[model samples]
Target: MIDPDLPLDEQNARLRAILGALMDRAERGQLPSRPMGQLSDVVALEQQVRARTRDLAEALDKLRVTNARLSQAERDAVGARNTLADALEAMGEGFAMFDARDRLTLWNSQFCAALPDIRDQLGTGLPFQDYVRMVSESAAIDLSGPAERDAWAAQRLQSHRRRNVNFVVPLVQDNWLQVSEQRMNSGGTAVIQTDVTAMVRTERLEREKLLDEQAQMVRATLDHIDQAVLIFDAKARLAGWNRRLREIFAPPSALLASGTPFTQLLNDLMRRRLLGRGNIRQVLTDWVNGPASRPPLGLDLVQEDGTELHLSAQAMPDRGFVISFTDLTRERRAIAEMHRMNETLEARVQARTVELEAARDAAERANASKSRFVASASHDLLQPLNAAKLFLASLAAMDNAPAQSRLIGRVQSAFASVEDILAALLDLSKFDIGAARARVDTVPLGPLFARLRDEFQPMADRRGLQLRVMPCAASVRSDPVYLKRILQNLVSNALRYTERGRVLLGARRHGSALRLEVWDTGPGIPPDKQTEIFREFTRLNPSGEAGMGLGLAIVEQACALLGHGLDLRSEPGRGTVFSVTLPQASAGPHAAPPLPDSDQTAGLLSDMLVLVIENDATSRRAIMGMLEDWGASPIEAASLTEAEVQIADLGLAPDVILADHQLDDGATGLQAIAALRAAHGDIPALLVTADHGPALAEQAERAGVLVMTKPLALRRLRRVLQQVPQLRAGQGNSAPGARRGDHSYWLRAGD
Candidate 1:
């Protein structure tokens, strides 16, 4: 087959080459098969052999690359182990890692140093028990005793066998360590021993600093507080005391400082007698055992040394208590003084009230007495004057010659002056004593001015001056009688003093008031004496026949009573003008009733029957004479009994009755009137009184009798006569009675 056709040497060489090729193939991991018989074929086989050799070389190169990678992996493993050991050494906690057998496999220098005495002895492969045993014997693990060390090691060893364990361990030199162990999945353990000495010391220092700050703050605040303060701890130790307490108690500084026992402080106080120790000790005991918050306890005590103290104590929520001491000596003394002053003032006020009551009673009695005296005097004096006035009028009625009538008129004028002076004095006294209560009424200025004009026109004619009264339709709010009196006085004064020129009585509208003015062209009041003219008894022209200066004063008082304003304007050598501002009112039928005209004598007086009841004998005679002059039949009685007899037995049915207000035998003129009316009929009557007071007016009004004051002209009687109707004795409509003195039916003031 080696190609028989070739030489045997070639066949043999071919076979040896084939064997060499097979050996090369086997060396290069190539399998050899049977060869082909040809040299070129052998060359092809050589080419195939070269290709297999190249593939084998590529596989060898890949295997060499894998070997280099394995070497690099081994180097990396060594580097990683170094890095792990360095990390473990750099850790804050001691590191000790054990294998599943509980023998130490890895550890750092810190782990060995954690047991300072056994540092050289600690290493890998040490059982956890031996390590704990070594640590237990060192000065680092200073347990309570050998028994405690053994127990702690036993308990730690038991914990080490578990999957996890964590605990703190104390060491020598105040050092502390927290030991923790975490079991791995391979049954190995990682133990961490953290040296927590710095953390524990830092926390303790911070706590001490906070406590110091709080204590300082408490002390500073308590020092500034006004009251003395003392604080006790939960153990009843004197934990805090302010500067004020030290000053107040005067105790030794050391005894008052913090950590001082409360019992000791109380004992010191008891020795010093600053407190009743019994009370303080009882309260302290209560505070220590009591439940929760309650009202603070308080005590006020006056010490033996004159120091007054107000003490209060409150129990803290979680601790002992706080106590305060306040001095109250000043407050106590002030309260005592105030009480004393109140007592004194009460006594004084009681005394003053008593005195005031006595004085008021005396004043009331005096006023009543004065009123009685004034009324009595006025009545007694007017009786004589009334008699004289009527007698003079009877003389004048005789148709005497001019000279005789002139002398009679002069005497009458003097009598009139006396009457006016008395009237002025009475009015002044009433005003001064506040006895004249005004009876206010609506006064129509028309009627009022008419009266004033009629009243002063004669005086104006006598003085050779014209009197012109301006007509006013305006009505006013005033007491008509008082208002008329005021104007009468003013006009009389004006006409008396005014010797020439005209005297004008007029009214003008002034705002809501009517200014009733009296203007005269006589000598005006001097500027200096204008205000003086209104005072009592200040006569400006005593020789010239001016009044006793009471006219304007009466004007002033009357204006005051009506609350009207009076103003006077004057210039020396000129005329004076007096204006009264009268409050204007609604004008209608509300004006005051007009007074009867004394000048008119219209009734038939001769046929009329009249009875005269006068208290004074002279007044009765005078009244009877005036009625006789008027030609009226008059019956006379001086007392109530006499008047009663004249009315009953005499069967007198008088057309008119003239009664005096103050009658004899404790009977008033009104009583006489009432008695006569009972026997006779409802007869018209007139009450004549010396005083025009509220009592007499009210009595007259109640009796349905007209009122007239004393010392009046006979013309007033004539005017009264006109009011009575003619009733003759033969008419016989009623019971017949005695008639007055024989007289005609009518008579004027001059008749």
Candidate 2:
């Protein structure tokens, strides 16, 4: 065995030397011989020694490699610690971090720089709560009182536990610090402090500059406006005023400064009576002394020198108010002048109105006289014309030369034209005087169209023009006579103007009316002349073709009277359409068939007894002669007395009495017919009169008398005579003395 104190290298060297010596001796066999057991012990001991040597060598190699790796690891740890320290020192913001257990872990040198009083106390192992407590208590933090400091510490701790938090704090040295905390992924907290003092100072400077500029601008604006302005603060002290206020009030300069009490200025103005004797003083005093949120107030004052001042006060949002004054002297003077002018104008208008009234009265008298003259002239003119027409009719009935007959026919044509002119004039006169009124009737368009077609078809053929009356089954609500006249005028105008092409008379159904249209392919009227055509005697063509140019004038007047809508459309080379719109009406009972003509019904009056009375001798003779011609037995007389005697001597009760409306001695046909009817028991009397006024017609209708205007056509006469028999049949003709009375002496004597 080797000694334990020897070095391992030396012991190994010695063992190797001894082993060599033993091996050499054993191989040479130069030793004493021994037993077999003893030889085996020696080999075993040698093998043991070799095995221990191999084990020792392997352990030594492993120890050397282990020492190399441990050395490198130590160097690496030192380098990493140095790098972390440098990084924390280079950071701009003060930074600190805490571990998962709420113990301080990392910090930069800048940390707690604001709280220098507590900076020395910071360390790696410090708990976050203790760190916040130290920061709150530091004199560097701008916090007051011990209790406030405790509350601040609690808030800081609470903020550090949240996911993310940020706040700003003012430092004692007029500096600002923005602190921000962030949660670490490893369940720690990070805090950052940013110095924001520069930014805060910039914002404050800008705000102060803006307020100064606004004050100057307000001062300039208040001075420029026309109204005097005064501003008071919430404490009822004068806050602002303009130059105009001093000029208007003329108050002492001492009272005009800012902060002057409002009551001082008010009292000065009132004592001097510069504010007039108005309630402006009381109103202003009450509003100023009342609630801050007062209603708006206003007052008007007039000074002794006739100066008008309007004072108005309005509240501001901050419980302040602005009062203003405006001079109203010029405005008041202008209003007074306007009122005076209006009064003068009203008086002038009243005087002019009186003059106009007198003129209107004079015009009315003249118009009345004209109407009377027209009536009188028509009656006097038609009487002789009636007699002459009768004589002409008698001449035509006799056998005469064809030439003589032609002459007579020509004379009759001239007479017919005269009659038409007269009739048109009378119609126009009635329209002028507003005497005509619409008599609405359910006039069937079918019959009216048919009659128009028949009347105009012959003329159309003579003119070589086609006239088309479109079939219409509709009826319309309108005055039958005026509606007929309107359509007649439209159709006649169309036919007259059109040299060729067709004239169409048709109706279209509108919502509640029928638009009766008359269309013609005519030389279309110019647009400018269309309105003129509706004026009297305004003929665009002026061809002198049978018309005096009053047709359209009458149409316009009649349409106005009837309230019919008339529209005309035409193009220069195209066609013309005149449309009349009237309300649609339900179909009414068909009218009675027209009375038969004299030729067809003349025999029906054979052996009919008729009495004729007249004031004009020629009219009486002519009417009596026509009665005989119509196959009637006739008694003729000139007045009521003459008719009674003739009736008594004739010994025949009259079947029909024909009497004139105007008789000699102011007696009328109505009165004569009444006397005769009292004697003859309601005899059917026909009044043949030249007067066609509404009064006479109404009177005759009430007396159960039929009226026919003067210069009547012979054919119409025969028709009326035929109707007399019908009337007698309806009234039942009386025998002589059937119901006699004192007025029936002639009838009593005959009986």
Candidate 3:
């Protein structure tokens, strides 16, 4: 057998010798007794042994190559370690590396040089947290003081686990280190520490110099200001003061020095009486010992010599307070002198005011008397005017020659002028005496516009002017009578002044009001004369015009009474626009306007009986005559008593009763109507009066009696008489023995 552990050459020689013997034995066939199979077996066994030896030789060769490569790698590793050690030693900054397990793997000599006490504790295989703990516990290092050591260690370890971090740490002897940490791809942390002590010292020196300069500037500014100033530290000790404080208080040098307690200084001032008497000392003491945060305090101090001083104290962000004192002596003295002088002047003015008040009272009384006279005169004038108007209307209704007709027409025109002047005077008096009242209603503009067009169309045709009134869809909140009169005066003024151009009456919607504007294309009023035109008896052209220039005056007063806003816009060569603004109202049924004036009174009052009770003889006769001309059977009486006698004794149940408001025996037409309705039935009655007061109208409305202000319109009178039976029927009342007829309805007076 070959020995496997023997040298390769020796083993090969042994194998060769064994193989040679076996082969010779097999080739000689010496032993005839041995079988050929056994000989073949020996030969095969030698072949297997040789194959095993060859495989062993190849394995030895491959092992030798692997051992040579491993030896070379080990040598390279030793050299790289030496190079890393040299590089770390040569670096300017201290460097350290922690492995993935957070164990200190490598560090340079300068890593803990600033803190030599911890140098021995830092080594390979030491945990990163333990290294940080040793450094934080080191006596040589100052982590902003000893109190922050434990916190610094915690922050250091936390930063070591982050990707990148940078911070500065201070050491004893004013040294500082800038530490930077970076994370490696192998999940290890690398820390680099740089000494920044020189740069930190340089910046600190510059900062101290700047602070010195600022302190000097503050000291200079405090000394120059007029107010005395003192600054206290957070501990309430005297920290700073200005020259003015020393001069004002005049305290001893020792008491005013720095480091003195605020209480000590305050007690010295109080003892010397330099500070004002009162609670000033106690207040200062409590404020000094109070909480760090306090509200600002201010007080005025009057000195013994009458010198005034204002003291103000406010707290700062550092829990200190700054106190200031300002002298107010000169200003106080000047104010006192001015107050004395004002008292003297006020005494003189009081005497004068008493005299002026007496004069004003007397003037007001005189004005009131004038208003009464004007009112009485207008009422008395209207009575006779009403008679003449009625009589003239009756005469005009009869057939006459053309020459007589023209003269009657002139007379009617003159009467119309007188009527307008009287009406304006009455309205002016009502406003002057404060007797006008606005009965506001939801007055629709549709019917009002229709009436205005009918009244002005003839005048417009005669003057060859276009008088256009736009259709209105809005309603307004105002007195129906006063509002219509205001618009009428405005329209009349516009047409009269406009020679050959058109006049426009329209309504424009403003926010909550409707602006009723009367626009005219005529010779406009000048800016200066515009105000003058609204004054009574003032006209631009008084020659050819029939008006007494009271149109605009009446409009102004009516608008004022109704509480409507009025505005006028006019230029010399351009047109004019007069706008009246009234509040808009919701849609509602309004009292219908008066029927259009017509001469056709033929069948309206034919065979209709009307009882006329008027006090004025001429007025009663004229009204009775006019009623007769309208084909109505009229009965005349002088008073309500006479009419009652006619109805009771004569058994005259008239279709309608027309009575005067101011009747004989202090009996108003309203009372008369009430008496007749009680005795007879709810007879349709009309009250005619020259007094257009709101009291009479309200009384008439309650009594269900219609009121008509004189001088009355004849056409209106005839129309009203025609519809009296219908009005009576609508009331569900008819006089006994009265005729019933189907007649068109007419709106009652004061509707």
Most accurate candidate by lDDT: 3
Of the two candidates 1 and 3, the one with more favorable lDDT, higher being better, is 3
TM-score of 1: 0.46
Candidates, ranked, lDDT: 3, 2, 1
Residue-level lDDT of model 1, residues 577-626, one tens digit each, is 99999778886442334445544444467666788887667557767777
lDDT per residue for candidate 3 within 187-224, as digits (tens), equals 99888999999997885564355335435645765786
- For model 3 the local lDDT of residue 518 reads 97
What are the candidates' C-alpha RMSDs? 54.8, 49.0, 44.0
In terms of TM-score, the best-performing candidate is: 3
Residue pairs of candidate 2 with colliding backbone atoms: none
Q: Score each candidate by Cα lDDT.
A: 0.71, 0.75, 0.77
TM-scores for all predictions: 0.46, 0.47, 0.50
The full ranking of all candidates by TM-score, starting with the best, is 3, 2, 1
**Candidates 1 and 2: which is better by lDDT?**
2
Worst 10 residues of 3 by lDDT: 736-745
